[model samples]
Target: MPVRTSPADAPLRIAVVADSDTRWKWGALTARRIAGRPPELAGFLLRGRATPTPRQLAEVGVAADALREVTMAEFLRAAEREPYDVVVLALVGGAAQAALHGLARLWPGHARRPVLVTGYVGVVYEKLADGLLLRHGADVVLANSRHDAERFRAVYEGVGADAAAVTEAALPFLGGAPHTPEPGRDTVVFAAQPSVPESRADRMYLLRRLIGHARRHPERDVLLKLRSKPGEHTTHIEEQPYQKLARSLDPPPNFRLVYGNMGEVLDRTDLLVTVSSTAALESLHRSVPTAVLTDLGVREALGNHHFIGSGCLASWDQLDAGHRPSPDPRWLAAQGVAPGEAYEGAFDAVRARLAELLARPALAPVSPYYTPVTAPGYLPGILARHHLAPDGTPLPGAAPETEATGVRRLVRDAVRDAARGAYRHGVQRVAPVIRRMGEL
Candidate 1:
């Protein structure tokens, strides 16, 4: 018999995967930074940009010449030859994972590989409701705050992620600036909008809070604006209560409504107010006050950091009950975090993780597909999620990322009687050809 070399079963392959969108840059940039770190990790980078620059790549503190940028297709083919070390799917949209898993069909032997996933839990702690639903993709989670870490641990283990095996890393450095603001201004300006609202009533309730806040404070003028995030349309903003409140209010406009040219506009603004906004950190470093408002009964997920105090953000009732109106100095300590320094620290932590994962012995993927999803080989729902077609009209000019995937196929399955029915009489021996097909 011809020997089967078992090339499909080998050491883990480490690849940084991401969508084609602009955010993919985060993973690539971070991976590049890691590749340029310590010597042990430099070897595991295997493929990605060599940190620093082409000229600076040589001085990356170690020898790492083999690493280079790779397309998703190229990666799928390469994994067929050797197992991967890790696949970091940084911050990517849901559609990206579908394509990544579909591409996994090209190489079918990595079912048990480790996947480090990072994304919001999409949990909305409304003022008076329980954390509505548990979210996934936070499976192997990397959370920055204590609440997020605890909540995620509860979520993943609830879904069976060998919580013991999962490593929880404290990510003090993962935070980002919402925007730069004027110095020494203590006034609070809230810039926030929840992407997904569970219901219209909940949405309107939050809106009324903002409007009520603005209306009650005869002095302090509040500004309500939407951050200019990519793929967000003004129409989406126009549909919100911010617009409706604008139409409803009489002449004494306490709140200023803003929509476009946000970055420039934010430069002149002071304190930022909202619910656990990444922007609050930006306001902090800029010497502006930030108050994270927790509606009526919602849990305040954004807690006070060692550098920033809880005072920045307040609950709606607290505003009514009267609390000391002062910004937390803890955040002032955060003023020390330089833009470049935080990025460097983040890169260092990531490199350390890569080094630890790659130095260990290799193992075959749980299945031939290193990506998410339980089964491989002619799996349905998995590939169908990719949302691509042979023609690209839905996506405009370019060709579809995927073609006709066809029907799902099954390799093998075992059955047992759940109903206590007449199993002995209902079951029968398979015919010769049918038995042969099963063997085949």
Candidate 2:
């Protein structure tokens, strides 16, 4: 393959591929931040179980120069056909790995490929090793905080993989004015996750507590900041929605469910509370009096364990008693919550690394850790899920017809809707019953 080179002053053409609303927000924002100047941005939303709806995209409010939905195979084909300065894989671990391997196959030998980047959307509490290794082959694997960057490097080095790819960066969505106490009405927002408190009972318990808090303090406006509506899917599967749980117990007028941009909601919020959502970090970044609920216990399963030393842990009882938790300054700094210049410069390293990569005469092929030789048993299954062979070639019938039209398009949409409905039904209705039966 011939060397693919471009002038240093040329405008960058960046592409971002994301799976869900949250990742899309992270990817789009990160792309802009690292682009140095406004570059040509193209967004690809992967068609998957958690594909964000139009409403979800609107709620996120991050626009790309061009946006479309594509399957993993389709995206590979597009990448092969087009040339991009940078490609951000804002996908889950398996999908990212699949794409990396497939891109390597498409752009083999000395062919210059785009600077590949992948990272978590927010706090990294679960699947440290598995996820990190899957994202190992990206040219840059972003770590959202210093703490995470250290852990990511440790994991890669421990596994005998290159640790140089771990780049320290802050979550792209972390920005808002410092929280100011409202003079007349104190707004308390509970940031709700789709599946953190997975059980109906646990969700009901939290809702009842929120309602109790509202009843106890009628003067204060309590808001349930929901991530998604009943039908919309997010990063995680919402087995039991708080909206449905709230209906069982009629809540006070002052307490209501609200959905929109989290930053906008945080603008008026005095107290922000959550189980383990990334909203806690966002709230802390803005100096909001944030609380991580300990009612569910600070267990790893709940992910509140990540806040163990942050000094933000509090129960509903404590919150109701007017005990607002303040984050430790040291913890805040380590978590990349530094305000002003520090926050602004978080993506500086990423930009520099990208500039270096893009300036190279010819780059090596995408070398993911999980290859046919490395994990013969596991790698193939992951690729097969995305309709790619172990060697990264698309399987038969993997590509969809070019833009289904008329009746065909309508039928396709209907089938997708039915599939989504079935998934929701299984999650919200059937899964809980099965779990209860297992408990017996």
Please provide TM-scores, in order, for all candidate models, with all chains considered together: 0.48, 0.96
Tens-place lDDT digits, model 1, residues 215-319: 777565667665432222211121233454346544246666665432344466654666654445445544454566655334433322222344565666676
Best by lDDT: 2
Q: After aligning candidate 2 to the native by TM-score, how far in Å is the CA of 293 from where it should be?
A: 1.1
Per-residue lDDT over 379-423 for candidate 2, one digit per residue giving the tens place of the 0 to 100 score: 999999999998998898787647688999899989988998888
Instruction: Please give the lDDT score at residue 348 for candidate 1.
Output: 50
What is the TM-score (0 to 1) of candidate 2?
0.96
RMSD of 2: 1.8
| Model 2 stretches astray by more than 4 angstroms | 1-7, 434-440
lDDT of 1 at 263: 37
What TM-score does model 1 achieve against the real structure?
A: 0.48
In candidate 1, position 29 carries an lDDT of 38
Quantify all predictions' global Cα lDDT against the true fold.
0.39, 0.89
